[model samples]
Target: MPDLEPHRRELHVHCYRMLASYEEAEDAVQETFLKAWRGWDKFDGDNLFRAWLYRIATNVCLDMIRRTSRQVVTMNSFAEVPWLQPFPDRMLPSDEEPDAVVVNRETIELAFIATMQLLPARQRAAFIARDVLDWSAKETASLLDISVAAANSALQRARATMQEKLPERRSEWTSAELSDEERDLLARFIDAHERCDAAAAIAAAAQDIRVTMPPAPMCFNGLDQLAPLLERAFGPDRDGDWKLVPTVANRMPCSASYLRRPGDTVFRVFKMDVLRVADGKIAEITTFGPSATLKAFDLPQTL
Candidate 1:
């Protein structure tokens, strides 16, 4: 048997991009491998093995999407995607794999993932294969088990939707790593959160910053809305004191927060806030529960 383990990480990234849920993507990759193993004899020796695996993975994601009740009409905000989850930066393929699809910061960012949920399953698959993976039209068609024309059409529609829905700034789609300014801002964010200084934290954020806690369907837009929430969170009556650990997710800066509640001696895992920085200020924050795989972030469950 071929060494399937070598392809696991990249395949996991692919499935992650397709499903936008870390747990579901992990499941899809496992299902893909199982299906590939069972159907190994059917795979042609002349064909690309990686592509074959991807086809299986894409189909698995499509089926998973079909089974879900979630629907995206117009994704005005990440709040609309209650199922959206963050991908750990450490789990991504290393830079040594120059050809890895996860190298593209734009494709793996939380905003991109949320916007992609707006696409239909096959269109999502087609877009990822053709655009992010740089597969040829015919190859994408073969992977999706569709005709070349249909694949091309799906790709076009997907492109149009992405173009219409994605952020308007050109720099937002670049492959660059987080800049020094972003790192500085992240440090300030962590400091403010840890100190429970609502004023300091709000000062670091943009005036029109947006905060959303996914799987909750709530959005706090602008400083006016976010201010009171921060005050309440940092208030004496708050459930706990916060301790934030600096981390990266989806190629963006993040803070893995732990809470030492009243009467509790140890701080336990709480939630993660992934920041989207713009113009040297924190523009958006997507908060996900600690349900994420913390080992990937090298984070201890308690402190």
Candidate 2:
């Protein structure tokens, strides 16, 4: 009702940070928009439109967290069926101003999101609103419907918990600050995957890189380990003729890799592999998702 398009996209991003699942974020944003429309007549344009949207989105996410528990996929926590889903890279709306103008991988990585899941709902909101979004304590307090002092307390607790859970690579976490060379490195990584060249792919990765596949509990660390892993995945014996569709997730450059099967004479979409780079080399890789959301990334299901 009030110039919704600009605020809508940002609100979607905000909801995503609150609720790591992309589908849930979409639902929350829809609910926020509907509520905004219904309450439009009573609105006073005193505060920023984005701020008002954040308030709605925050409340929506809070309701969701109150109802559902955080998703965990560790070895001790494996279940009869996988419970979490990866966000499709293609569905994330592009920015006219480039990645610099939007959120970064440091704040939105799957690792960070999983770490956030450990915090209480209000503490999670307070930390993200204050630290990640750069909102002031007073502003975050107003949005969360709590006192500024309480917000500050929640944020501090959240930060302390996250510091222990996440890796200590704060310098490389800022995705907005990636250099031209770093971007080019990602481009080359994509090119290598599309060409199905394992050597080139290995060359692009760090010597001791860590590749983690969520919801699967498979992890390969170090170049020696990763080389064999890549060979098994992309080699001629298994899932040959690989094609990587360019996309993004967690505010980081990503690709949904598809495999061309000779027996079926068609390409089958498979994994969503999201990358994290540091110092112009692939540092971490997290892969997941099924065919349902894979199509949303504009990837070829059967090429």
Candidate 3:
């Protein structure tokens, strides 16, 4: 039998894009590998091994999606899909990998992942395969076991939906790396958290900034709604002293926060905030708990 380990990372990323959860993607990759090993005799020597693995991985994701009741009824905010999670940059394929799927800023960002949840399972797979992965219509159809015409139709619908739901300026965002403006804004954000300065944080955010904490039904829009939360976070009787470390997730600027409650000597991992910046200010902040994600970022549990 041939080695299957080489394809693991890219397969995991493909599953992540389809399912929008890190843990679920990991499971899907494992299931794919198991199925591939069991059915290796079915594989033709003439066909590409990587594509075969992807076919298995994609189907695994589709099965997982069907079994779960994680459908999104409306395409509004990231909070609406509580299952949404950030993909750590450390696990992404390095720029040097030849066959690695290009993890561009537009495709892997939080907004794109959350919006993709609005698509049906098959359409999401089609979009990722045909458009994101640059697969041919015939190739995608073969992967999904559908006719070429049907695959094209699915890609069309998926593209239309993505364009409608994604931000208008998405087309204009060309840089794959973080810009200086974004780094500056992130610095201000981290400094504000460490200093407990709400004003500085607010200044770094857009006037209509939005905040959402997933797995919790909390969504706050605009600075007016955001102020009270910041006030409480930095208040005299707040949880404790805060420490923030800058990191990158989903090709966007992020901060991993640590908190030391009253009498707690060491700061402990709290949550991660993935920022979506617009016009030099933070336009959206999607926050996730640190327990399931910190290790992916290679962050310490306590400081």
Q: TM-score, each model?
A: 0.96, 0.79, 0.97
* Poorest 10 consecutive residues by lDDT, candidate 2: 72-81
The runs of at least 3 residues in candidate 1 whose Cα sits more than 4 Å from the true structure, single-residue gaps closed, are 170-173
Ranking by lDDT: 3, 1, 2
* Ranking of candidates on TM-score, top first: 3, 1, 2
TM-score of 1: 0.96
RMSD values for the candidates in order, in angstroms, are 1.5, 4.1, 1.1
Identify the leading candidate in terms of lDDT.
3
**Which 10-residue window in model 3 sums to the lowest lDDT?**
168-177
lDDT of each: 0.87, 0.71, 0.89
Better of 1 and 2 by lDDT: 1
RMSD of 3: 1.1
lDDT of 2 by residue, 24-106 (tens): 78789999988888887877788876678778889989999888866333321112113345555444445662222266667
Give the alpha carbon lDDT tens digit for every residue of 230-271 in model 3: 988998878999999999998889999999999889999999
Q: Which candidate has the highest TM-score of all?
A: 3
- For model 1, what is the error of residue 57's alpha carbon versus the real structure, in angstroms, after optimal superposition? 0.6
| Cα lDDT of model 1 by residue, 145-236, tens digit | 99999999999999999999988784555764778888999999999988999989988999999999988888999999998888788988
